[model samples]
Target: MRKLGVKAAAAAVILASPAAAEMEYSFYIGSQSAPHSVLSGTIDGTAGTAIDSTVAWEGRSTAPPPYYGMRGVYWRESGWGYGLEFTHAKAYASDADRASLGFDSLEFTDGHNIITANIHRRWKNQWWNGRLTPFVTAGVGVAMPHVDIQHGGGAHTFGYQLTGPAARLGAGVSMAITDRMSAFTEYQFTYSDNKIDLDSGGTLETSLITNALNFGISYSF
Candidate 1:
């Protein structure tokens, strides 16, 4: 009788294992907005004085280089999950800043890219016949922004740079569309600390906080 009970328990474990874990892949696109931050740096090498100015950022979401993101997650039945996410977010210094600060070109429109490893917690709700799930996520990673700055009659500093550290927090809800598909909308807040090196000389330092609203679809397997 003891041997039979042990065998039955083993069979139950095997049967439940497949349903206990799953993998999900998602793609999303959205718009972003950033508040004004101070941008400070030195130009023309060590011969120049420090430049400090308040910069207003513009998010050209509808134009070229739109905002987008992708992620892959692995979920356990316990409502906990882990994933990697990549976001292509942009920022352009406003015209007022350019005219006032006398910058010929200043932007990270090509990429204010962020890559992070995220942890998520989700809850299953009875809304819409148990199809709605609400989740929150937090992550930390690095910022790789394309530094585009030309000022003080110096050479153009245009290239990708591993500027500094980045972190994000987000919350959203997902609706099940099919057995293996779901749709979601989320809001994310990201902070990046940038210490970018300039081509003609010293480094530019700034902290950017961005807010994004995103919608997308996911597939689970």
Candidate 2:
């Protein structure tokens, strides 16, 4: 009879669980890619070693097959959402070519890595309502870019560390493949200025503007 009573209490507690407890925490990683545009345009596009450049970007949250598009995880409703995202990106300038003289004979490469954290608010049944599960978030991250420049018959390496603001927005769907696990995906953008300063006062600042195609998975407590 004692065992029966314990089982009955367990059933009652399970039935009484609050829906908000259903909110999940997520963790994820994607292809880490960053593209950069070097200013002071080598051949000289700016004054005082400033820059004049334009560039394109791609988000690096690269995924393997199977859950192909499962790049995002559901966020919590009321407070902080903790997770790690890996970013990869590349940059190039059509105007920064050898015709510019900076490349006597040329080859160059640029990429960056970033990690971030954010605060969230479930737009629907959220911290505000438990049924409207849509959500949005904004946060900040740090970036490390590896720069390789091959010019004037030599290779130069410059590593850059950048930190700045980032923002994300998306709608929430079912949070799991099954219970105890949940998933979500959102469109996010991180903006940072990656710069390299030279003792000669000549500098290269590739305001690494990044856009990511991020995706990942998570387990909740």
- Judge candidate 2 at residue 150 and give its lDDT: 37
lDDT of 1 at 82: 99
Which candidate number would show the highest lDDT if scored against the true structure?
1
Candidate 1, 1-221: lDDT as tens digits: 99999999999999989989999999999889878899987775566757798899987866688888899989998999999999888889998897788778888877889989999999966478899999999999999988888885678999999999999999999999998999999999999999978887777889988899999999999
List per-prediction Cα lDDT, in the order shown. Answer: 0.89, 0.45
In candidate 1 the C-alpha lDDT for residue 52 amounts to: 92
Candidate 2 deviant stretches above 4 angstroms:
1-38, 41-51, 56-86, 92-111, 123-133, 158-174, 198-201
Instruction: State how far residue 137 of model 2 sits from its true place (Å).
Output: 2.0
Measured against the true structure, the TM-scores of the candidates, in listed sequence, are 0.95, 0.54
Model 2 C-alpha lDDT per residue in residues 1-221, reported as the tens digit of each score: 99999999998888766544434445444443445544544322244433354443333233322111222334443434544444444443434454353533221233444455555555433432343244555556665555444344434444553533433333343344555654555555556665544323344555555454445555655
lDDT of 1 at 9: 100
- RMSD to truth, every model: 1.4, 7.6
